[model samples]
Target: MFCSTELAARLEGVDTELIIAGSAAAAARRPGGDGFTIPIAGGVAAFAEEGSPLDKVAGLGFAGVPEPAELDAIEARYAERKTPVQVELAHLADPALAELFTGRGYRLVNFENVLGRTLHDDPATVRPAGIEIRPSDDSEFDLWIDIAAEGFANPDTQGVASHEEFPRDILANAMRDITAAAGVQRFLALRDGETAGCASMRISRGVAQLTGATTRPAHRRHGIQSALLATRLGLAKAAGCDIAVITTQPGSKSQQNAQRSGFDLLYTRAILVKD
Candidate 1:
């Protein structure tokens, strides 16, 4: 007798916890900074570093409208750290929270479409000619990071500016640390035996979240991403994951590729920032 909305909320909460945990682990490895999570009124606030990547308050949800005092305290905490207060609000999140933030000057900065699909039978996909996808090894770690950084730097992608400023060494270190954490896997896509793209999966609570899927500009329109997506789906299923989820910018080629590969839109999440 569980409602679909309730189920979605529960799943989202689990996913958010995994994200916060992984971020905290990665932040712990930072040379001069640390990552931590703070419990707020609705959900947890995850901080990676003062000005580092993905330093934001995310997975925000509330059973009911939160009091203004609670919101104020959250903002004050981030302000004290000299970083912008950011929140990610899923479609199912309390609408009142959005109103409260907007009234307090939080700008709607970005949007991400959450897509998911059940992993049953292995999805059929043809590996593009001269392309191969395989689990990454230590030797290919640096190459994977380089390809990911370049793919995310494309101006056509969301938050390209943030990705552009990411230092390669910092990113490489973070990736190495996070991927080493439990239930995380990285895959490399090679075209003619040369690295062309990368994808990552983090499994938790019977769900696999596919993230960091990127293909170099020169490798686009060649089905590299689609092949990787299919490969990961099969891997997730083989790893005992019941469902797979992915997030991407709305109307982007990434979304189109995911939908074509069997993922359906679940909901859209909005990113609000107070800077």
Candidate 2:
């Protein structure tokens, strides 16, 4: 599919809404959690909590460029809570957005790529022998979080350097809140009857978002991720999603895997931060 401003708007809009929903879930699940969203320029700034992974600005510059005063107010909002402003600006967004951020002392921190593929029929998949993928049961929520946090804590070293890293406890917390969000479905990959990997998908407005997936360090290279991806894609297709999307650190292993599965690079987001 052609990458255009209109396409970017659609993709980013879904992501922004997901963030809002997840933040709201976090607030309801955690003690003293803050679920707040502010409109800045054409984007939405989200704050789930101090140091929460869900905190960031998305879908910026889709409406129109913001004045310096509006940017100042956005910055002030984050500053009030001792949090830095982290904006994920799509490359296809208005060029003036980046210029405004630079002029306002925002520093370019990292880049993440968004890849997508249209979904129609069930995706063809190769399931490694002895591996099984299934929806996680409600009773296994803690187990799911533990596996996800463990995988994240021991991330693969082959990828591009990560833009941001968090402690295992923080990762666990984030996973819990994300799972609490409406429309999110969690899946577990088992190898020889042992849990080896975990993944999640969220469908909104006919867009299936592969929110995240991780394999236990010991389970890496066992095709667990591929199985998880295939299962999610099939589920998304069956759920009537028109398209599916995923975000990954630029040049990272996740990006490599998605490409191997026939997803196309739709856009890259520059993570600009102001502290």
Candidate 3:
């Protein structure tokens, strides 16, 4: 399928909006609730904490290129906090945006691919034997967080690109904050009466964002991930979302799973960092 710029605009807009909203949610839940979001450079500059994944800029350059002063102000926000400024610029965004970052000393750090597929009618839900996928209840919040964190800790290295790794504690905290974001839904995959996998979905503006999914090291290759994906798509369609999107490291197992499930390569985002 042809990937159009308009489609990129819509998908990236939703993703970035959620990033901002998720950061705001994390800020409010903290002790002092100290966090901020700034609308700059035709996108958003958000900070949840010193090393938060959310402390970055996104959906940039869709509007006219910002003046150098505007870019300087964005850097100042992070400079005051003594943290690097990171930008996730979509390949389809205004080319000048990339040039501006390079000219300002932002070096390429990483890349992530945004994949998507249209949701129409009902999804063909996959029911793998010995596995059950169901909504995570409030009482199981911590359990879900632990399972997700553990999965990330033992990541699958069967991909072309390398992925960043974080401490297990930090991963747990990030999962908690993101799952608490507005409209976010959690799912737990059970096998043999034990939790085996966890996933999340967030719906906004007719888009269903497959926020994350991971299976425990001991439970890998039990069709847990596939089941989780199919279940979320079905629910997202029921909720009236026309599009479902997922971001993954290029050629990772996650991306391969998404591709097998009908998602197309919508666009790639270049992560540029200024330290």
Q: Residue 105's C-alpha lDDT in candidate 1?
A: 94
Q: Which consecutive 10 residues in model 1 have the weakest lDDT in total?
A: 155-164
Candidate 3 C-alpha RMSD relative to the actual structure: 1.7
Off by over 4 Å in 3: 31-34, 161-163
TM-score of 1: 0.88
TM-score attained by model 3: 0.94
Candidate 2 versus the native: TM-score?
Answer: 0.94
lDDT (C-alpha) at residue 130 in model 2 = 94
Model 3 C-alpha lDDT per residue in residues 1-275, reported as the tens digit of each score: 55787878887778778778878877777768557788865688888876677788988767778889988887988898888888899999999888888999999988999999988767787998899999997799889878987988788988755435666665655666776776678999999888999999989889999999999999998899999999999999989999999999888999999999999998899989899
The collision pairs in model 2 are none
Q: List candidate 2 segments past 4 Å from native.
A: 30-35
Residue 11 lDDT (model 2): 87
Worst 10 residues of 2 by lDDT: 33-42
